[model samples]
Every structure is written in C-alpha cells, then in structure tokens.
Target: MPAILLLIVSGFYVGNTVLAEYVEKEAVKVPLEAYLKGHETGKPEYMQKAFHTDGKLMFIRDGNYTTIEFKDYIGRMNGQPAKDEANRKRYIESVDISGNAAVGKIVLDYPNARFVDYMSLLKIDGEWKIVNKTFNVEPKNSSD
Candidate 1:
C-alpha cells in the first residue's frame, strides 16, 4: 500500500510540474513574440496585437517622469527596420506569472542604444496582452 501511494504521489508531482510549465509558457509566449516582431519589422499592427489599446510606455527622461501613450509610441515607428538591424540583439530575459497577470523583462541591444523593457501583462479573455511598459534606454558607445 505504501509503495502504491508513493507512485501516485510521484505521478501527481510530475503532472503538476508539466502543467506549471505549460501555464508559464502560454502566459509569456504571445506578448514576447509580438514584441519581437513589432520591433524587428517596425510595424504598428504587431505592437497593437501585443499591447492593450490603453497601454502606456513609462520612462524617465532628463530627470522627469515621462509617458508615451501606445498610439504615439507606435507612431514613432516609421515602418522601416533600422539600418543596422544586422547588429541588433533582442532577448526576453525573464517572466513571472501569477494567475492571470504576469511581468516580463526584455533587453534590446542596438548599434545606437540599448533598452531594458519591463512589461506588465494580463490574461484578458484567455489571451495575454501587455497592459503597460516601462523602459530605460542608454546610448551605446562604439566600444562595449
């Protein structure tokens, strides 16, 4: 009886682990994918797909807190990839999810600047979408 109980417990543990991984992946995948495509292609449709309409980008500029609404931010994109796209690097560093909400950190390294982005996301109607984004951008030097 004890052996049988142990086997059942082990099976439950394995199943739980698998389910947790699935939840985490599903929670993080869509937003990151959209974010990557939008930045790489410089398209607003991809950005709109990833973010909520009211999402805002928050950052500090010249010692003042500044915000950019999603529409304006999307407008800043010129629908053209950066000239040095070959030298750019983008990565999703980490994501943490709880129930229907999540947070993610991403890094974008370009020839001219490096950006660290923090995204707040929620699962709305069975889909995960970014509701807010805040980032820090630093001008890059020729070396390092």
Candidate 2:
C-alpha cells in the first residue's frame, strides 16, 4: 500500500512539473511559440533555422490558393517593406511528439482574419521541421 501511494504521488508531481501551474517550476516546453514570433518579427534567418531546406509553405487568399517553395518565400520577403509582413503572424497552440513525427496546431493572426491550422513535422538530421500542413481560415463572425 505504501509503495503504491509513493508511485502515485511521484506521478502527480512529475505531471505538474511538466506543465506550468500549481506552484511548479523548471518545466520545459517546446520553443515553437518563440520561433513563430521570430518569423513574424522578420528574422528569416532565425525562422530558417527551424526549417529544412525543402520546407514548403501553402497559403490561400480570396478564391485562389498556391504552394510556394521555402527559398522563394524567403527571397520574396527579403526585400519587402516592414508593413507587408505585419499581417503575417502565427501562434503555435500545441505540439505533440510521437517518435520522429510531431503534429502542431497554430493560429494565424491577421487583420480581420484568423485561422487555426495543423502542421506535421518530420525529424531530419536530428532536427524537427515542418513537412506539411493542412489548414483553413476561420470565417469571421460578423456580429463581432
């Protein structure tokens, strides 16, 4: 009975220590949120550090949709003015890891627009990078 109680207590403490709350500290979390902010801040170099060379990006606007090469995406953003990049921000909501694959959900924040998306990650060369994403923007609530 004592042994079982000890194990239960230990598990409870460990779970609390992992996720913030209930007076726990030193709990580690994924760095996806930081990277998202880095990308939004126009630090492509920092953003690139998290992506594989073959990373691909897909976006939709109006009635047209397209997938763009990562290199081209970076190149196009390189010389653009700051205002153009302001609407481009992603907030990573969660990350789940299973072996070499991870699934992440992010919320895109734009002027009068928003989206919740799921991105699949593949670990290549010991680093996790986005491989593909399936997403759709949320329809605006006219009542707001």
Candidate 3:
C-alpha cells in the first residue's frame, strides 16, 4: 500500500512539473508573437507591447556596431507596411525559458534579406517583456 501511494505521488509531481513548463513556454510566446506582429503591420504599438521600456536592439551596420533604444526603434516605424509586405515572412523559430527568463529566436525573411534575431526576455511584474535583441542579416543572394 505504501509503495502504491508513493508511486501515485510521484506521478502527480511529474505531471504538475510538465504542466508548469508548458504554461511557461506558452506565456513566453506572447511577447514573441507581438514582436512579429509589429514587423508585419509596421505598427510601433505592437513593438512597445513586446519590449520593455529600457530594451535595446544591437547589431552590426556598415561595419560598425550600432545600438538603438527600443523607443527609438519604435519611432522609426512609419505605421505603414512595406511595399512588399505580402512577401515578407516572420516567425518565431524557437524559444527557451528558465525560471523567469527566456530567449527567443526569430526569423524575418524579406525580399532583399533574411534576418535572424535573438531576443532576451524577462518576466517582470507577472508579464514577459523583451529586454534586448541582437540580430544578423544575410542578403538574399548570399550562399547558404
């Protein structure tokens, strides 16, 4: 009887752990989806919803390292989709979470270039927000 009780308790614990992890993963996707929506719609408000106020994006541009505050980046959005928006494809490739922190890999395939972005996120005040982003772009003609 004791052995059976132990087995039942163990099963419950494992089930709860798996359920919790699944919930966290789904929660992490919320911000990532918002980020993708921002790019698709050319709406800065969606970006703001995904990023923390102090977040920043870093990348190499013209052989120089460049960093832009999230606010500045959002400001650059003209609230109009690109002329070739129909051809643009954006998606979250993967997301990994540990405790209250998470990382997401995003891919943006454009007519001219492909961008791979790594975003770091933190769960603060019971909400997840992207805190930093770094990405690399490859020209469409580049050899894979």
Candidate 4:
C-alpha cells in the first residue's frame, strides 16, 4: 500500500511538471506570435507589443556591424505590406525556455534573401517580451 501511494505521488508530480512546462512554452509563444503578426501586417503596434521598450536589433550591414533600436526599426515600417508580401514567408522556427529567460529562432524567407533571427526574451512582470535580436541574411539567386 505504501509503494502504491508513492507511485501515485510520483505520477502526480510528473504530470504537474509537464503541465507547467507546456504552459510556460505557450506563454513564451505569445510575444513570438506578436512579432510574426508585425511582419505580416507591417504594423509597428504589433512589434511594440512583442518587444520591451528598450529592445534592439543587431545585424551586419554593408560589412559593418550595426545595431538599431527597436523603436527605430519599427519606425521604418510604413504600415504597408511589402510589394512582394505574397511571396514572403515567415515563421517561428523554435523556442527554448528556462525559468524567466527564453530564446527563439525565426525565419524570414523573402524572394531575394533568407533571414534567420535569434531573439532573446525575458519574462518581466508576468509578461514575456523580446529584449534583443540578432540575425543573418543569405541572398538567393534568381536561378536557384
């Protein structure tokens, strides 16, 4: 009887742990989905919802390392979809979470180039917000 009770308790603990992790993962996806919505709609409001007020994006441009404030980056969006929006594809590739910190991978496949973004996120005041982003772009040839 004691062994059966122990087994039941262990099962309960394992179930709770798995449920907690699933809940956390879903919570983390909230901000990531917002980020994707921003790209889909070309709206800064969505981006603002996804990132912290002081977030920034880092990448290499013209052979020089460059960083842009999230606000500035969103400001460049004209609230209009790209001309080739129909041909552009974007998605969250993966997300890994540990306590209050998490990281996400995103892919932006454009007609001319493919971009892979790594975003660092944190849970602040019970909300997950992207704190930083770094990405690399690969150009594609028309023939390929």
Best by TM-score: 4
Model 4 over residues 37-127: C-alpha lDDT tens digits? 8998899999999999999999999999999999899899888788899999999899999999999999999999999999999999999
lDDT of 3: 0.95
List RMSD in Å for every model shown: 1.7, 5.4, 1.7, 1.0
TM-score of every model?
A: 0.90, 0.62, 0.93, 0.96
| Better candidate number, 3 or 4, judged by TM-score | 4
Clashing pairs in 2: none
Residue-level lDDT of model 2, residues 68-123, one tens digit each, is 77676656545333574655556667766666677778787765567776766776
Which regions of candidate 3 are displaced past 4 Å? Answer: 142-144
In candidate 2, position 23 carries an lDDT of 22
lDDT of 1 by residue, 1-144 (tens): 999999999999999998987877766778877988899999888998999988999999999999999889888888888888889999898888888889999999988889999999998988899999999999978787
Off by over 4 Å in 1: none
Give the lowest summed-lDDT range of ten residues in model 2: 22-31
lDDT, residue 35, model 3 = 91
> What is candidate 3's TM-score against the reference?
0.93
Where is the poorest 10-residue window by lDDT in model 4? Answer: 74-83
Per-residue lDDT, model 4, residue 87, is 94
- lDDT of model 4 at residue 53? 92
